[model samples]
Target: MKLSCTECGQGRSITDPVWRCECGGLLQVEQRLGELDGEKLRRVFDERLAHRNTPYASGVWRYKELIHPELPVERIVTKYEGNTGLYDSEPVRRFTGVRDLRLKAQSENPSGSFKDNGMTVAVSQGAWLGYERFACSSTGNTSSSLAMYAALSGKASYVFVPEEGVAGGKVLQTAAYGARMIRFKGTYDDGICFLERHAAELGLYVCNSMNPFRIEGQKSIVYEIAQALNWMLPDWIVLPGGALSNGSALGKGLQDMLATGLISRMPRVAVVQAEGASPFHRMIERGLKELTPEPRPHTLASALNIGNPPSWKKAAAVLQATCGVTVSVTDEEIMEAKAVIDRAGIGCEPASAASAAGLRKLVARGIVDKDETAVCLLTGHMLKDTDALQRYVTREAADAGMPVSSALELEQVKERM
Candidate 1:
């Protein structure tokens, strides 16, 4: 595989210690898959479902040839990440008005978030490069996943997060995994800017989605979804847009599958950003060629509060390639969707609920057909951000005027019931 600049079309060796091209464009991995047999590969992937081995056991590594064909098995650092569940929830289907809606619960991964899928590949690639330290700037999930994987791989980890707005559970999880936490009184975009400026000087291997290796690993999410559907393509793939890395990765993976004859059609990607932090959405709505960053992005979905996403260019390309749509939803809409998912016993973090809310909007607007098959990706587990849940419940209770009342006697309780 070779690293290719998204803008300048410059090619560089994969061993280069650079995240971006000299022109400051993001780098993407260009893999060389020699004459892949779709049917044979499908059978092999199906058989590996029961392999119980090192690489195949991991959902990301199960499709190693497509992910990182050059990486050796002995150098892999995996926690058997991926293998997350896909559920058909009646409430979610009804809420979105999509009859064939499948919720891809990525929260079931090792780190309670989809970040583990990318972290395994990124950390393994860093280890292969003989790096002893790894680092990333995150809102929550990325830091937690990085810390966990770094601890497992015996590498030092450094996490930079905004001083405020991050969920308590994510901070606790990162600390528990023994990462050196660094907080700044700014946004996640600020933290990422700082890291981009000083990561090389500090000799840190950045494992954020900006790292092409991370995107390579995350592509497995698409692979797993397709494999679960017996190699059939979905009509739409809905996901929350934060850094835009997941959507970009999904688009790339789908293209790869199509080129290799694993699938025949492309799924229209629908990326949902928080209304307060919807630069990409605005760009699409205004018919702009470039994104204008939100100066002070605010959202109840902490993970989607990034103002300037680094992967916007890649995401834009994906949207263009797949006839994708971008939309923004209010915090109220996000919370309402969260409640629906929670009531259905398929809980997700606030950010993850954005997909459902966005899908609902798309369906209402006639952008997405209710009869078409769609897979909504829930990025993180509900427990990842208990603070958001607490606030949501408290506000809901206040708005509804006390959902419960004290009952001193059994008669009173019975009467209330």
Candidate 2:
């Protein structure tokens, strides 16, 4: 496999540990396609899925041919990262006014977030390269995933996050997994700069989406969605955009599927971001080539509180190819959507609820047809940031029209006391 720069088109072999191009552009895993033996792939994938007891059955590794297939099985580090369920969420559908909206509950992954899908492959590649240490800068989910996978692969792990920025659940998970945790007194983008300065000198493998392999691993989400639908493509795929890595991967994955005849049509992709951290949405709406990132993005959904997303260029290009658009949502809307999703018994993090909130916005704007089949990607579990949830259902978000039953429960408890 070869890594190609999105800007200058410079190519390098996968053996190179470099994450970016000489021109400081993001590198993409340049993909090539050949005639796929559809029957054989389908049979083998179905057979492996039927077994479900081995690593080969993992939703990610089962599509290895589409990913990096050259690695030996022993070099693969997996906890069956994919294999999430497609939850038919009636509450979300009613709230968003989308008749066939299904929530793809990625929280079922081993790490309670979608980051595990990419981390498994990234750590596996590091193992193949005989790397002893891996590193990443994250808000929360990525650190937790990297820590867990690095531990399983017997590799040292280092994580950098904003001081007092990340959720305790993720920080605790990383520390419990024996990773060296470093807290920087800055934002995630600042942490990225910090890691870049130290990664090469320290001989650490930086495993952010800036590394194309992480995007490659995320492509499995597309494959799993198609497989779950029996190779039928949805009309739209709505997901929350933080660094825009998943959006970039979804567009490229769709192109690959189209080339391989796995799906006959294209799905319009929609990436939703919190209003405070919506550089991509701003650029798209303003028709600009680039954006000045938010100086200090603030949102209750901590995961989406990114100022400068590394994958912005790649994400823009892919969204253009697929006729996609970016949408922004407010914290109030996100919590209200979260409450509805929770009422449906399909819980997700506040950031993950952006899809539902944005869907409502898009539908109101007539950008998304309420009748079209749509699938929303829920990227993290509700427990990923429970403090925000509690604040909403208990105190600060009371005027935001949160579920009445939760407030009623508090009243009942007070009366009982």
Candidate 3:
């Protein structure tokens, strides 16, 4: 695999420590191979999955032919990332008013978010590149994943969090992984800027999604979803858009899949964004070519509170490729979706439920037909942002139709009863 700039066509070996080209364009993983044999590849991946003893059993590495195909097995570092659960919940189906709904929960991953899908490969690449130190700026999930992967690889890790920061749960997850925590006095964009400015001087390998390998790894999510459904393409793929890396990765994966003849149809990808932090959605709504960051991005789902997503260029490319559109939902919508998901016993973080909220919005708007097969990618676990859940369940910020009290149980027996 080689890294190629999206804009300037600059090329370098994948092992190079370059996230962007000299022309300041983002990089993507480019393959130097003949036509991919999708059928043979699928058989090979199936063989690996059947063998419980092999490293190829990892959902990401199982499709390594499409994901850093040349990386040696021994050189890879994995905490068995990926292999997250994909469920079809009747309650969620009814709540979203979508037929044939599938929820791809990345929360089941080792690091508790879709970031682990990328983190495994990116950190492995960092190790293979002989980097001894690594760093990233996160709203929460990215930092937590980076810290865990860095620790597993025996590399020093640094994480820059937003000044307003994120839920203590995620911050504690990062700290528990032993990464040196640095707080910048601004939003996540500012934290990213700070990391980029100091990363070279500090000799730290940047492991954010801007890293092409990181984006490449996340494609496994799409791959897994396709595989779970016996390689059939759903009518729609919905996901929360924060940094927008996951959407871009899914789009690229579909392109590759089509090239390899894995699926016969392309799914319309819908990137769900929080209304408070919906610059990408606004750009789409206005039919504008240029993207502008929101001056004051605000959302209780801290993970999606990014004003300036570095992956915007790649993400926009994804939308163009899949004929995808953006859907922004309010925090109220997200929390209500979360409540339904929680009640269904398929829990997700607040931002993760944006996919459900957007699905509901799209269904109501007639954008998504009720009978269409759709997959909603849930990005993180409920515990990743416990503070948000606390507020909801503790009745501090109940939604319009939320249940005020739970059913009476023996644990809380009343003398009057």
Candidate 4:
């Protein structure tokens, strides 16, 4: 249960709340791989379920042993955020030219975003570490999710979001959870900088990408994917990247499962980002092996509008280990991909759609074969930013607006057109 700095080799106890090493590198979990008896771990985890079996119901708890220690489990409020559906995607398969396609629909989680997976674990760890207050800088989803979980964990939550980010439904959701919502005039980048410089004095736990527990929770998604596929690894895992912690966690989780003999092969990880805010993509274009986060990233996919992601080094390690590739899609293409996914019965945020857009790009470039098995990680629900989505959808539906209530009437209008 000890953690280590990947860059400096400085070891620390897992209970410490330190965010980074003296070398200014992200701290990574460094667990001993003793001949891990997977069955034994499962048995112990199952026994602990008697207290509140619901934690084991989904997400991190389902793969509890991978990240959690053998110590007493802390109680925190989570919406049982993980273990989202591994939905079969025929449309995605056809579109991406990947014959076997599945979607890890994290958007179905309580807060309509994959950040819940991180928030739940971070909140649990905070409660365990005697922290009573939580805070983060988010575009939208993470702030709202952390606030909701903090409320359940008897912790005060503070969220700092950009003034523009507050335009979506996210601001209301965060406020509704009774979190201290601070709006910044700038983007998420400014908020992150402000939080980092001020967090210690404010006595607030910076629960953004720096917190190890969030990535630990995110690792559960890979475990769930393996379990859903009967422990078979996919050829690729596609997901949108902002802070890149989730992508990093996927690589680590897969490695953990491989070590434990839970799966046989490792998957190639693919990160998708909007073209307007693609620092990772720019790094690739420059023949750089890692992403050096910019200072003012902006995009229609607000969740991915991060300038300087704290976990950039860890993310580089992840891509290196997984032989991953990063792709960038234009905002227009992401919007089109969103419409396509929605037509396929999977409504998603722009960031989530970026994953599918990446797949399409891969197919166009003749990189991914039509028969390859791929999994698109849909990170957020479309409803998370309802106001923007409403404008988008309503503007498209303007032609059919005259007192059309029934489905038949809508169809009739379409037929007329």
Assess every candidate by TM-score: 0.97, 0.94, 0.95, 0.91
Q: lDDT tens digits, residues 1-417, model 3? A: 688999899889887888888898899999843578888988887777785656687878888889987788898888888888899899999999987999999999998999999988999999988899999988889999999999998899999887783888999999999999988778888877776778888999998889999988999999999988999979999999999999989999998888888888899999999999999999988998888998679999989999988998899989888889899999999999999898899899999999999999999999999999899999999999999988888784254434556568775445223
Residue 143 alpha-carbon offset, candidate 2, angstroms: 0.2
Winner of 1 and 3 under TM-score? 1
Please say which candidate is ahead in TM-score: 3 or 4.
3
* Tens-digit lDDT track of model 2 for 77-125: 9998899999887778989998898889998899899998888888998
User: TM-score for model 2?
Assistant: 0.94
Mind giving the per-residue lDDT tens digits that candidate 1 earns over 1-417? Answer: 799999999999988868899899999999765477788888888888996867789999999989998899998998899999999999889999988999999999988999998899999999899999999999899999999999999999999989877888999999999999998899898988888999999999999889999999999999999999988978999999999999989999998999888999999999999999999999999999988999789998989989999999999999999999999999999999999999999899999999999999999999999889899999999998899999888988888766467758997777656
Output the TM-score of candidate 3.
0.95
| C-alpha lDDT score of every prediction, in listed order | 0.92, 0.87, 0.89, 0.79
Scored by lDDT, the top model is 1
The residue ranges of model 4 lying beyond 4 angstroms of the native Cα positions read 39-53, 74-76, 165-167, 289-292, 398-417
Model 2 clashing residue pairs (backbone): none
How far residue 327's Cα lies from its native spot in candidate 2, in Å, is: 0.7
Q: Whose lDDT is higher: candidate 2's or candidate 4's?
A: 2
lDDT of 1 at 132: 90
Cα lDDT, model 2, residue 138 = 92
Q: Write the per-residue lDDT of candidate 4 for residues 221-245, one digit (tens) a residue.
A: 8877886676787899998988787
Task: In angstroms, give how far residue 304 of model 4 lies from its true place.
Answer: 1.1
